[model samples]
Target: MGNDKKSELEQWLEALCSDPFSSILDETVFRVDVFETETEYIVESELINCTKEQIFVTCENDALIIQVHENENINKQRVVHLPFPLLNKNIRAYFTSPILEIHISKEISANHPNRYMITIHEIDL
Candidate 1:
């Protein structure tokens, strides 16, 4: 199939580098996709070889910071800035193996902390 004809999952998989080892040695932490709908913004991050327990997410001001760790020694961090100011309560996240999906609502759920850890729900996919 042509590039435009590919499914989202297929495109996502293909978007991942064919050489997986180089991702670790290279500066890029992981591949990320951010898109918006009428209701919310979706943040999808490809967290390769990482477990739900190894990932940490925090909402700080206008940015969502993702921290990943394979162990005490190996750590990687990525900061995703929001298109608009959002509260922590408006954010929800799920972890399914190599993909961590975060959904941010356009409307505020409630006033929460300026900096707080977001609960990561493990969903079978």
Candidate 2:
């Protein structure tokens, strides 16, 4: 049973990598790391060239917590603790600048048998 689950996860990751939207993002400009704690999901990211820019991070479900740190002069940071577990499996975040844009999305679809879509948009901030 464990091997089956692992195989399923592998296939899903491959599909995400081949997604059209994934191809357009600047993979070098943003970094995402997921840390699993005993009861929460910790997602940390470092967004480059986004200091003074408006950052928007969202997840499909409202249960996951968020913490953001801006590498600016003042060292701005924000932490949001979610009320429940994120079950939608369509988490995303967007950062926009006058000349550059960054968007990140995880969990393209739910763990169910149906297909779902996750979209990210970046506009002038």
Candidate 3:
């Protein structure tokens, strides 16, 4: 692509057709990392300028959903899909400033999916 500027029509079209978060965020601002260990799954997310109270996390079915609610209209959401199913119990989440880490125990999930909210605790680094 060239350095040419997009026309007004193109800009408007892009704005209208963009995804929910694409128009309001740079995507790179909220980076998410997901990995698996022998016994557990780990999800680390970069949530800058966010308060622990404003962040909501939930493990449902095969995905862990991370959401940062800046306000009613502006919010950031990311979903980390687990390689294998996980049970909500034995999950530990520690948040220190811009980094949020979630350690989820690997368990054979139930046939009926369950959704559980994860409480984030602040830890002194």
Candidate 4:
């Protein structure tokens, strides 16, 4: 009780209860960049302050769900499981500012060539 005799609201409640998870420890997951070239398959997300109706992109089973309605009591989801399976009617999305570029279109892009980088791995049966 002796931090200069406390009470500035008890030193702001001792600096907000001294980190009880530090406000959920920042970063509620939103940072992605799954690259590829020669024919597309690029999904980027930064979404500063977010918009485009609070953002929402989907592709289900072959994964690529990046939702962020941010209200109605906070709901921010992210998932990007794609090892192959893109070109759901040739996708394309762009949102300049803080980036949100998704341009997937490669079902067999003439048998892949330039840059060719699409590797997603996660296995845990």
Instruction: State each model's CA lDDT, in order.
Output: 0.77, 0.40, 0.72, 0.58
lDDT of 1 by residue, 24-120 (tens): 5334777766766888778888898888889998898878888897656548887766545666448899998888999988776878978888899
| Ten contiguous residues with the weakest lDDT in model 1 | 9-18
Q: Candidate 2: where is the Cα deviation over 4 Å? A: 1-8, 27-46, 62-125
TM-score of each: 0.73, 0.32, 0.66, 0.26
Cα lDDT of model 2 by residue, 39-95, tens digit:
334454555555324344434343222223355333323322333335545444433
Candidate ordering by lDDT (highest first): 1, 3, 4, 2
Q: Global CA lDDT of candidate 2, please?
A: 0.40
Candidate 1, superposed: residue stretches over 4 Å from native: 1-27
Ranking by TM-score: 1, 3, 2, 4
Off by over 4 Å in 3: 1-29, 72-74, 107-113
Which residue pairs overlap in candidate 2's backbone? 63-84
Q: Measured by C-alpha RMSD in angstroms, how accurate is candidate 4?
A: 18.8
Error of model 3, residue 13, in angstroms: 34
Return the lDDT, model 2, position 67. Answer: 25
Query: What's the residue-level lDDT of 31 in candidate 3?
Result: 72
The candidate that achieves the highest lDDT relative to the unseen native structure: 1
Which candidate would rank higher by lDDT, 2 or 4? 4
Please report the candidate that would top TM-score against the real structure.
1
TM-score of 1: 0.73
